[model samples]
Target: MATSSFSSFILIFSLLSFCAIAIPEPRPASWSSKTFGPDGPWNAVEVVIGGVGQNRTAVFPGHAWHSWFTSTDYCFLTSSDHCNDAGGYPLRNSGSSRVSMEFLQPAQEWMAGVRVAGEDGFMYLDDMDLLFKGDNTDYITKTSLAIISDQMLALPNGTQYPALLGCLSLGSPEANQTFVEVPGPNLNGTMIPWPLAKRGATPSSSFGLHIGSGITVARMQGSLFWGGYDRNRVVGDVLALDGGFYEPILLKNIAITVVKGASPFAFPSTSKPGLLAQGNSSLSSSAGLPIVIDPCSPYLSLPRSTCDAIASHLPVTYCPNLGLYIWDMTSPKTTQILTSASALSFTLPGGTNTQTLTIHVPFRHLNLTLSKPLALAPTQYFPCYTSSGTRASVLGRAFLQDAFLSANWESSRVWLAQAPGPNIQPGSNPVGILPGDTAIQSGGNDWATSWDGFWTPLSEKQANGTEGIPAPAPVGAGNKEGEGLSAGAKAGISIGVAFFAAGLIGLGILLWRRGWIGPSTSGFARQESEIALEGRHSVEMETAMPNSSRGGGWGPVEVAGTSVRDPIPLGEVDGTSSSSSKKGLATSGRHVRSLHALA
Candidate 1:
């Protein structure tokens, strides 16, 4: 009897120990960030669309575009050949392999009008994947990766163009990006960071983006930190501002500082010239032209007078056809301001509650290279374009190159600081953020003292002693996950589990013989309701289309993505920190919100 009892004890102990060691507990907020995209500028990711077998397709926009722009890859999901020709976009064999939004459902019928880079398309709820290419691809699925489809025949001239690239819009309220689909896809566009926050994968839904300076000099290197910020990127005093969820970001005024060679820039102005005021340059932060800092804006769309004012001071001339300031190589001042330390600064005067932040952009950094399609050849042009048709005076991708933006989404607080060059620190200085009102952790290398104020350019090694071609993404690259246990370890665990199971059976037999165990019956019943979310929330009404279905807006907009009434799930995104656990994202049943009553 003692021997049998001892054997039973050993089995139970071993099984319990295995369970304790193998099962991971809930992890502390974990953050995983990686660099993405192809050589040249832009951030690229694998967008897999279509779920119905042959119709399912994957498109990597980085490889499709023959030209270079700011950070991002873009493509239209419309099934028309005209869309391919419209934007100088490469032909995709009559939209055969295009990501045709296989996840969309017509029965639920949720659609919204979407306009991008002058091209108009209807946005739809999609069950697709947004994979961030890294050492392992990190992804959020059953989410809206923005599958916009358009019929060229519906355009004013049937000649509209697609945007050069698309953006992973990280800011905004969760309801703005998409709504739940019946048997609904899991997450939405705005909710990308939310799952990380909810799963304890990140501290909060707050993320920071530093789109490094000088496309050629930046080497397409940047950081998108979730639940944290790269402290090495911040310089001097942090300009903290409130209100990221609704009101457009307003600045006191723009301050331009230039060298002797530049004319208009040499004299700092409190306000823009007369004609520029037509576009809202004269408006104050209280109202007027709100400054929208978006990574999607490929260039600096300043007011016309602002663009002309700056152009008058440089060796660049505006090309109306392309809407770009072509650099004049023959100009005597070209060598001066282009090479000299001239800076344009954006000032946001500190209110009693907000601290002032002045971000300086180097004049040299404004000079970007243009390739075929957008340009005839390798031409140098100023990225500042006239904000003729935009909703506001916009600081596009160009501005982000010098600004480090961090938003505490839970509290709706935003802070912008000067972004330091790559070598300002030895390593990618990522610091975890505490949830809510508490901001990001401080950096490992404090660069407040060493900050050069964009006066002198940062140092860089000339690749191959000349401007080298940007690196291409590795083959089979769009995968995401932590370095998990190897196959051998997994096999071992399986075998061990089986052995444990056999031992339990033997223990049961022994206990039964000793009358220490008895067979009992118990039943568990679980029922889950698949919830569908449907509705529409619009911010700005589209001109002439008072009834236009809208999905997103630069300002505060809530877009209800039609979702599956049945439960949809967001699979777990593995946390990278040691404190994290194996708990993946919650299943569809846990997060079903009934949004069927929206107008």
Candidate 2:
């Protein structure tokens, strides 16, 4: 009946499947964002291991040398669709100096994006814990043996587990082992193409067979389960199985305070915040470990060109001129700027609580919001005194615990929304301007002055006339000289006396030639009379010359071409000729003399 019920539930679940798959939210840490925050899906999350003044020894789960909070061993695990098998391994702390980790089964695993700093000044990831939710409580072993890949183990059926992927060996005092052979149509499951099985196999061991093309295999450990409560109980807090609702759990307190000889808004103390205790600087918590802020990280939202300019003026590790202001959570309207040393310390009204240390970091330019809070880790000492790397800013846990903040990218304005704890006193709008924005604001006037008088779009103008391109002049307009010349322009004009005399002479010539009046009555009367007398003399000469000419034209005549008549008199020629000439001589033949001589 139990098997039938389980089958029915599986069928129902398959039928109710939706085409769209829901994506999981990012883990609580801000560092996870490097891969999966607002960015998207990620392959891994890394973390640093090392608590406040505590460390691990054996590098295994139960055999650990130190664990201040819990007595029993707690092994960290990782899982997804990818891994050697499905098993996980234990994470070790730094104080013990053990550097290697081991896994039990062919389980899927992931790295925690945690960073740990050594006394020598090196920073790196330590270990990660797996996220799982399930209950498998029936366990009978106190030893809780985990088989490593290098170890040799024999199975009940002539097979060895560590041959390919290792197995975790657990001893159960009870006779009934939780081994359920899921028998059904194995149409879609993980398939392995291993050529040979291991040497020993056991009936009590769990084995899974795979059958599909895309299916894969992984290993997982048993989760503690709860049944009937007994006086002699071996169970403990099941963080993975608890589903009850509770009040908000205090993670860490954040504050913004002023510090002398350090960046404004100093971080929490080095010894606090049970994770990543490298030194007192700026840091945050994500994936259960401290994530120190590297202000120089390229992932910061500052523009590339501006960042380059700033890097040239200041060292990559430190910038003394930089400042910040933040508002605490308690006083929403009160903002405090960490401008000087005296304003650094924060004292809450009810006394500050260290647990509520996480603060939300808002990035105005990236359009990103970080829910994870920043923390301050211990300072690391390097071999040389040249510590040139980036140090975390004052926006660490201690400062975040006491402030609220808002920033505007367009205006380059940042506002501290409120004060948090009682120690964080209230103030007016204690906000900051980003360095690049400040530089632009200060240099705007100079830039505008340089670009003035040049043609540009009309939209660029400042309310106070401090920035932007100036307005253009009207079309068809020139400078001062052009305006004055335009006022006197006219269609007609006259000049002085000499010019007037020339004009009158031209008028008289035009009237005479155009026949406006007779020449006799025109100007210069005596000249007109002489011209008429000359015309009469020419007419009389023409008439008298025609009368003098006789009927026959004077010329030399000859018979049979002996001689041509004398040249004809020009006076008897056609009237088109200007004048007629008198007859001078005539000849009868070539040998004949003139007519007068012949007579």
Candidate 3:
């Protein structure tokens, strides 16, 4: 029995040691670390709307446009370095100056050429200017490496339109030339630029595109992560696709359900809860419809038949005067009628091992207002444009607001997740988009060990060469805990508190002494007297005659062609008149005389 007990003790000790060795280490608390490799999963610069400071936020007047603009200090081909400089002409030059032109192309009919480098690099333009701050360096470097613009559009007729980067001046008119040119047509009918076309063979030249959604409309500081995505922001599993041609991302099926009120119009009784499915053999009606995700467009462009089916249930009307279809929700009842009218669900094809992905869109996204360029006057409108032809259907910002998209160009695959709602707190954990793989492991780490096993108390350090991970900053250190406060800071805070308390007490005492705290006899009497005087003054002012009449006479009547005798005073007219009447008349006459004198 003693030998068996000893053996069991040895076995337990071995099992504990193995478990400890198998656990993974906890991540550092800093904003970023080198654990994810040198090419970071860095935090994307936030692009805020309607806030303070330069590049901190931009005011978007209308909901139609999604174009981003930043302030730029430099202009192309300008020799005047101090055009808008605060200093005089020919200011000091720096050795680190470099010059590059930035071509800004928005979905709107506007384009601009911004100078990003050289001696005139740090010049400032207006609020609409595109500034090349330090944050833009990554994009700039990636553009230079690719030696081509990524804004190319593939047409339906096997034609490709290469976007213009900008025209760079070589100091002379003849030497000035465009930076990137479109390659001639090829036999294979490939639409991709030559530089990006070779990306398949040369994977090193590839990059990723990550688009982040802001939680709330008011605090909508959306982010565009160029290389990777914030792992914490994603709500559901990330669905990956092999690749796409003209429309890179596609949806397999679309299901529309009216969650609350009755449809504003009518639909077929057979299709109570509308379901438009594709790909699966069961859903026949929605088999041929192709859907594309386009953030550039603010509205969802659907096929005419599908749009008609959906529109039949919406409470909208065509306003010929405004030249737009308004979602006549001006009335409170009409607005309430659509409290929870409809919901749109998008389904994507997933492989056997993975579950299919679906993104849900509420009626709130579809119900928006037209502002600025889209309308002559601001009007409530629904964004459901229809196209009868066999053009690819588009899912715009209305769909993306609730969905997070991560496009990895290197792998030619896109990962999408259901975005967290506005109420959800944002997390700082970011995960890198690895090249060539559609499948992603959670936490951006593939280690088999558990994270808890590696978590050691910060007070203990390993005697070996391995360094201990620093603990997270103490909670409320700089706030209520006063851990970050200096001796002088603590003293100042105490003094301030004391002064504030004393001031409050002094104010209360003064209010009490003045009988303002509660009603006192003397204070009440004084108020009553003031009120009585005001009442008397008002009566006297009302009885006083106009200045012109006051100077003319006291109480007389005039006829157009006849003289009328003035009426005698009450006291004089009747011998029985009281003394009060005489006093009132005298007071009135005195008030009338004073008014005339002031005038």
Per-residue lDDT tens digits for candidate 3, residues 479-594, read: 11112456897899898667555555555565578876884545211110000111121112221222211111111111000001112222111111122221111211212222
lDDT of 1: 0.43
Worst ten in a row by lDDT for model 1: 62-71
**Positional deviation of 264 in candidate 3, in angstroms?**
9.8
Q: Write the residue-wise lDDT of candidate 1 on 13-122 in tens digits.
A: 65575455443221211221322221114433333332222121222121000111111113433332222221221223213323222122110011112223222222
TM-score to true structure, per model: 0.58, 0.15, 0.41
Q: Give the TM-score of candidate 3.
A: 0.41
Q: lDDT values of the candidates?
A: 0.43, 0.18, 0.32
Candidate 2 lDDT, tens digit per residue, 1-599?
A: 99988655544443332111121111111011112211111111122233223322211110100110111122112121222222223333334422221111111110001111111101111222211112111111111122232322222222222211111111111111111112321111010000001111111111110000000010001111111011111111111101101100122222222222232122333111222212323312221211211110112211122233222211122212111111232321111111112122221111133322222221101111111111022111100101111111112212221222222222222222122111111111111222122111111112112112222222112211234323332222111111222223322223323434444454445556787646465441111000010111111111111211100101111101100122222221111111223111111111112112211
Whichever of 1 and 3 has more lDDT, that candidate is 1
Largest lDDT belongs to which candidate?
Answer: 1
What is the TM-score ranking, best to worst?
1, 3, 2
User: In candidate 3, what residue range of length 10 has the lowest lDDT sum?
Assistant: 168-177
Q: Ranking by lDDT, best first?
A: 1, 3, 2
- All models, RMSD in angstroms: 13.2, 55.3, 36.1
Candidate 1 regions exceeding 4 Å error are: 1-40, 43-137, 149-160, 175-190, 218-220, 258-289, 350-354, 441-553, 561-599
